[model samples]
Target: MTFKPFAAPTALLALGACVGRQSVLDPAGRDANTLLTLFAVMLAGLIVLWLAVNGMMLFFNKISTRHYDESTARKLIVGGGIVLPTLVIAALLAWGLSIMPDQRAPGDGLRIKVTGEQWWWRVEYWPEGAATPIVAANEIRLPVDARTEFNLTSAYVIHSFWIPALGGKMDMFPGRETMISLEPTEAGTFRGQCAEFCGASHAQMAFDVVTLPQDDFDVWLAAEAAPAMATDGAQAQRGAEVFLAEGCGACHAVRGTEAVGQVGPDLTHVGSRKSLGAGVLEPTIANIADWIAHTDDLKPEVEMPAYTDMPEDDLMALATYLKGLK
Candidate 1:
């Protein structure tokens, strides 16, 4: 027995349902769910309109053969095609707009700044009643059950910041700022990627959003604000010297040292980050060594040059020192 192909209308409906079940339509969290529901409704309405138009055309084609005067049938078809679709689409547009958040009053929420560069993210936290902002890179930690507003912008090219579990993609345009407000309803680690294609390393440009309980989040924030840990041992001291002497200082910054360049991710507390190389690889000593040795192999268009010219011992020492940055 051979299976038959599905009819066009049935196939379209099935495809629509499949698309609806995905996160882009039926999202997990509350805010995201609301947005997805609105989008799904609009999509479903459009699909219905498409089917109706095709069905009407087929009906007219059949009726014209049987009727001596097909003018009345044509008029009916044209009127229904224009007026009915217009009404349905207008209603859907109104309903979708109704659910969209009001941009005028965003309310009182925790404000954070996210700046997108070539292949990484620069995160800055401005808590309520704080003088100086807390700066971090790649990883973002948010308190569960709090409304957090992100002021997003791009340092170089246009990029989109998206954490699918929390909210929708918000574009980061150069020189101009955009805002995205979301409330993480639960505590968990969610993966985030740069939604737009920015450069050669765009595929490797990923990040993690670690959502924790309010108390845990506060503790982590306090720890992040504290001074960088001091390095001990002869290897680590030598590694620090290699890091400063070998042009790594041109891009990276380690708070208390002379490596104060802002072109690359800050290595001030890099050891504490869950993953290294913008979530491209795990934060192991070996992975760090490989990244330092062959950055181009891991990420071809990364702005940081490969350190393959460095001696193996220097590479090991540098990795060891960076791993001790917590």
Candidate 2:
């Protein structure tokens, strides 16, 4: 009886989880809408088939008293047991396969190359016929209504790229590249995750998906292509010195600065990112400092070493500078 009081709210809460930034049911693009439609159609068809079968059983056992002759029973068994199920299954299969080509359609001039690493994403944007790519990490931005193609590969083990609100999942393999195109119809922020289990921190590997108006997306990309903003503040200057002294440049890159290492994520415009540590922590000053001090504690088995011995003031200064890279 006590469970009855909470059942409605609990059910509602579960249903609420099905329609959010990361949910397939709450589609924000054409491919996702198609998937939702196919799922709904199949579910409805199966429900009707289930009721028919059970209803026939109910009629035979409880409602009907007269027994049918052999000929009539055989007809019922053939039509209901075999023919109906076959037709329903075939129709659903055909409809499902027919949408594949559209899902793999070519893009509209923009190509994004994403390389999956141990637990992070390396993202590059290449405009049509461009000689150079604009590199970013752990974030993807797209222009709404324009189909952008993704060239996906992995640096190590396998990883599956999936943005539930936008489209289907694609598997990324090392030494091989795969392609998928997604056209976002809605202008909003969403989330993407590595759908495959790669390593110890597989669950922590997530990325931000942002869809913007075409003009706004162009402005953002242009800014992203430029070098990092100059370090102006006194604290930022000291943080830059600390970054150099600590040999952080050997693994990270801050364009227009001495730190030009590319073994890890590019830090050219890291300050503008929404999250830090490959979406493991928020981009707050305290959180950044904490991540720098305790990388392993926050995200286990990561390649980057923790700066546990750094002085408190220097740690805070570095975090501040990183937070101001925008």
Candidate 3:
């Protein structure tokens, strides 16, 4: 009958999980910090209002022995119900409005275009004055101390672009683009997720946000702009052959190779990314192989077809080649 023992542990577990790298409370960027400050101020104001209103009721109902005069009761009602709340709310609203401009500030130099798909993300980096974008998938890298702007849109249904530690959520429309800027002050890898519900795999649609030093980010951008790495091992060579043979090129692309397809996320530097299948699994050979054979099992309603009938050796070889691309 009593679930009190279970309730305490469950609440603690939930609270503990909230303070991770994905939390808004653990801010790493200017916009996130501003938002956190606003939240703190609003919460403080709300707490004050709650205590004041409840304390008045408690005093009259439980603590007070004598009834107050009509004038005193009228003053208490006006102050607690009308004047105090109005002042607190107005002050909080003004403070919130003051920080809105910074959240909408323009980017320093780097601009990123993100497209939300069925269950994944297509990321393109367009540095200032660049003619073409350097394309990657399911991972975002931002230079520290620079305000980076993201142009977000969805290819299918609506999706909300959100990096909780870095900034607030911006709704991504189908044909129209929405923008948000974030200036990261810390260099760390955090988690990002699609805040909007699109389909069955909405919960699995996630990405990694890696903030790097300016120099390192520049080097990475240069590397990402280049073609995929050459296959060195014989097993990897066989995997490349298998990849082309199986028509994986029809949907996926591997630069420097003939696997040119535009239907899915680019695999040019997939091996170097933090996770695979849009944060559904680690980028390990075993996991890759498992994903290839059980795509739908891992992420329901995903667009990619499972290669369940492929031979074991071919599966391993393909995973090996893809894993070595980094």
Best by lDDT: 3
Candidate 1 C-alpha error for residue 102, in Å: 5.2
Computed on alpha carbons, the lDDT of every model, listed in order, comes to 0.81, 0.92, 0.93
Preferred candidate (lDDT higher): 1 or 2: 2
Clash pairs, candidate 1, are none
TM-score between model 3 and native: 0.93
Query: Ranking under TM-score, best-scoring first?
Result: 2, 3, 1
- Tens-digit lDDT track for model 3 on 162-278? 999998999999999999999999999999999988999999999999999999999999999999995699999999999999999999988888888988999999999999999
Shift in Å, residue 150, candidate 3: 0.4
Candidate 1 lDDT score at position 300: 76
Clashes of each: 0, 0, 0
How do the residues 33-121 of candidate 2 rate in per-residue lDDT, one tens digit apiece?
A: 98889899999889878887788778877999698999998988888888988988899889889987777899999999999997899
Q: Write the per-residue lDDT of candidate 1 for residues 1-326, one digit (tens) a residue.
A: 76667777788887665332123543435567677677779889989998889877787687645663678766776677888899998999898777767322262556789999878899888888888877789999988877788899999899999877667788999999999787777777777889999988888888888888889999998888776684688988889999988988888878778888888987889888988888899988889999998998998778888888899899998998999988
lDDT, model 1, position 248: 89
Error of 1 at 292 (Å): 1.2
Q: Which of the two candidates, 1 or 2, achieves a greater TM-score against the reference? A: 2
Task: Tell me each candidate's TM-score.
Answer: 0.84, 0.95, 0.93
